[model samples]
Target: MKVIIIEDERPAYEKLVHFLKRYSDQTEVIGAAQSVQEAVDVLQQKGQQADLLLMDIQLADGLSFAALDQVPLKKPVIFITAYNQYALEAFRANGIDYLLKPLTYDAFSSSIDKLKQLSGTFSDPLQSIQDIYKKLSKPQYKERFLVKIGDHIHSVPTEQIQLFFAEGRNTYLVNGAGRRMITDYKLETIEEMISPEQFFRVNRSYIMSLTGIKDVLVYSNSRLKINPSFDFKEEIIVSREKVAPFKEWFGGGI
Candidate 1:
C-alpha cells in the first residue's frame, strides 16, 4: 500500500511510521506533511500516487479537514486524533476509520483491516463509513464535574474550572474561586473530555483554561511560563516543543 502521513507532532509521526513498518513490509510511505496548507499541497500533487492517507485531525496551522476542503481527495483517509469531537466530521470527509491518540498497534491493525475489507467488499467504501456515522450519536464534552468533600457532593460547572494539574499520582482541578478538588480522571482522559478551545495541556503536568490565564511570560530555553488566576505550588512551564502551538492557541489562531 502506498501511504501518506499528515501529522504535526514529530513523536506521533515517528510512532505511526514504526507501526506501519511493523504492520507490513510492503506498505510504502510515499509522502508526509504537517500543516493544513502543506497537506493540501501534498494531496494535490501526489494524491494520484497514494492509495491511503493517515491524517491527524488537528494541525499546527488549522484543522486537517480544511485541507480536504481545498483539495478533492479521492484517497481513503484514516483520521487519528486525541479529541473525539471530530469523528462525525472525519466520516463526512472520506474517513474510513477514526483512531484516537496513544494509538495501539491492535487498533491500527484493525482499522487497516477494516479499510481493506470494506474496499474489497463494497463499491463505495466511504459511503458505508458515512452510513455508520449517521447511526452514531455525536460526542459530548463534560459540562459539569461532581466532586465529593467530607461525604458531601458538589457539582461544579466545567466553565468554572480554572485548571487541572497532576500531583504525584493523583489529578486535581482548581475552580475559578481557587478551590482545589480531586478528580478520578487522569489528565489524558480530562484532555479528551474538555474542549480544546477552552483548555490547553501546556505540559504533561498541567492543563490550563483560557479564562484561567493571568499572564504569559517568556521562560528559559524558549519556553513559556503561565500564571493562572489561582495559586499553584509548582511553576507551570510550557515545553519548548509546545511553545508554537501554545502561542497559536493563546492567540486564538486555531
Candidate 2:
C-alpha cells in the first residue's frame, strides 16, 4: 500500500517504517511530512496517490488535527503518538486506530489487518474508525511483568517496582526490596508500559516511581538530585533541560 507519514520525530518515523517493513513488503511510504502545515501541503498535493496515512497527533507546528481540518482525506489513517490519554480518547471519538510510540510489529499488523478486514462492505470506513479505538481506549497500562529467572519465571507487579534503569544496553528493574533483575524491555519501551502518573523518566537511564523518590537535593552543578528508596548507587541527576518539567511533576502536574 502506498502510504504517507506525518510525524515530527525522526526516531518515531523510522520505527514506523521499520515495523511496516517487518510486517510486509507490500507497504511503501510515498511521502513524509514533519509539521501540520507540511502535512496539509503534502496531503493536498499527493492526496490522490496515497492509499493510507499514518499521522502523529503532535507535530512541529501544531496538532495533526489541524491538517485534517483543512484537508478532506479519504485514505485510511493510522494515528501514531506518544501515549496521551486525552489524545487517544480524541482519536477514539473522531479518527482511526492509533499506535503508541516505540512502535511494535504486533500492534502495527493488527491495525493493518483490521483496516483490510473493514475495507469492504463499509463504504466509509474512517467514519466508524472511532468506534474501534473508543472500544480499545480503556486503561491498559502494564500491571505486571513476567520475567525469566534462570529456569523459573516470576511475575512482578507495578507496585513493587521502584525504577527501571539501563546500563550499557542492559535494562534492569529495581524492586522495592532493592533487588535488580534483568528485563527484556528497554527503558524507553518500559516508559510507555507504565502509567506516567506513577513513573517519570528522570533521564535517559532512569524511569523512576514517585514513591521511590526519598528526597531531593541541589547537585554541585545546580542540577537537582533525587535520592530514591532503593539504592541506585548512581547519581540520579535531573538534567538541566528537564528541570522545569521535573519540578512540575514533583510538585504534581499542572
Candidate 3:
C-alpha cells in the first residue's frame, strides 16, 4: 500500500515513519509532509497515484480538514490526534479511524487495518471538523451572550452584561449597558462555554465575571455575598461547598 503522511511535528512524523517501516514490508511510504499547504501541493502533483493518506487533524496553517476541503483526493485517511474530549466526539461522529498521539505499534496496526478495510468506501470528510470548531468557539464568557435579532446576530461582550439570572425555566442576560436578552440555554451550559479563569458560578442562579465583582461580604453559615458591578434585586451569594474552589481560582492556589 502506497501512503502519504500529512503531519506538522518533525519528531512525531519521523517516529511514525520509522514505526511504519517496521510494521509491514507491503506498505511503502511514497511521500511525507509537515503542513496542510505542503500536503495539498503533494496531492496535487501525485493525484490518485497515492493510495492512502495518514493525516493529522491540526496543522501549522489551520486545520488539516481545510486541506480535504480544497483537494479532490478520494484516498482513505487514518487520522492521528492528541486525545481531547471534544475532538474525540468529532472523530467518532465521522466514522473515521483515529490513533491518539504517542502512537504505539499495536494502536497503529489496528488503525491501519481499519483504514485498509474501508479503503474504497466513500465518505463525507469536512462536516465533522467544522461542527466541532463551531461548538467550541461560541459564548466567550457567561456574561457575553449570543443575541439573534431577526436576521442579524451579535456577540454581546461580557463586560457589558450586568448579571445572569435564572428565572422560572429561562435564563436572562441583563446588561448594565442597557439591554436585556433571553437565551435558550441552561445556566450550566453557559458555565461550560465561558472561560473558567474569567467567570465563576457563584450560585445556582448566577455566574459573575471577575471584572464585575465589586466586593465580597461574609454571610451566615459560612456563605459569602458578592456585590457585583451591576446591581441585582437579590444579593449574590456563594455556598460553603463552592468557597474553596472559588478561593483557589482567585488566589492561584495559595
After superposition, candidate 1 runs with Cα above 4 Å error: 120-254
| Pairs of residues at least 3 apart in sequence or in different chains that clash in candidate 2 | none
Model 1 lDDT, full chain set: 0.88
Sort by lDDT, best first.
Answer: 1, 2, 3
Q: In candidate 3, which residue ranges exceed 4 Å CA deviation?
A: 83-95, 122-254
Clashing pairs in 3: none
Winning model by TM-score: 2
> What are the TM-scores, per candidate, against the unseen true structure?
0.53, 0.55, 0.48
Which candidate, 1 or 3, would have the higher lDDT against the true structure?
1
What does candidate 2's lDDT look like per residue over 65-85, in tens digits? Answer: 788778876566778777555
* Model 1, span 92-207: residue lDDT tens: 78788888777899989988888788773347756766754653445557999888888988988999999999999989899988889988899999999998989999999999
Per-residue lDDT of model 3, residues 69-134, tens digit only: 778665667678784443644354343465667778887887666656655664545654554455
Error of 2 at 126 (Å): 10
Query: Model 2: residues >4 Å from true position, as ranges?
Result: 85-94, 120-136, 145-154, 157-254
Q: Give each model's clash number.
A: 0, 0, 0
lDDT for position 53 in model 3: 78
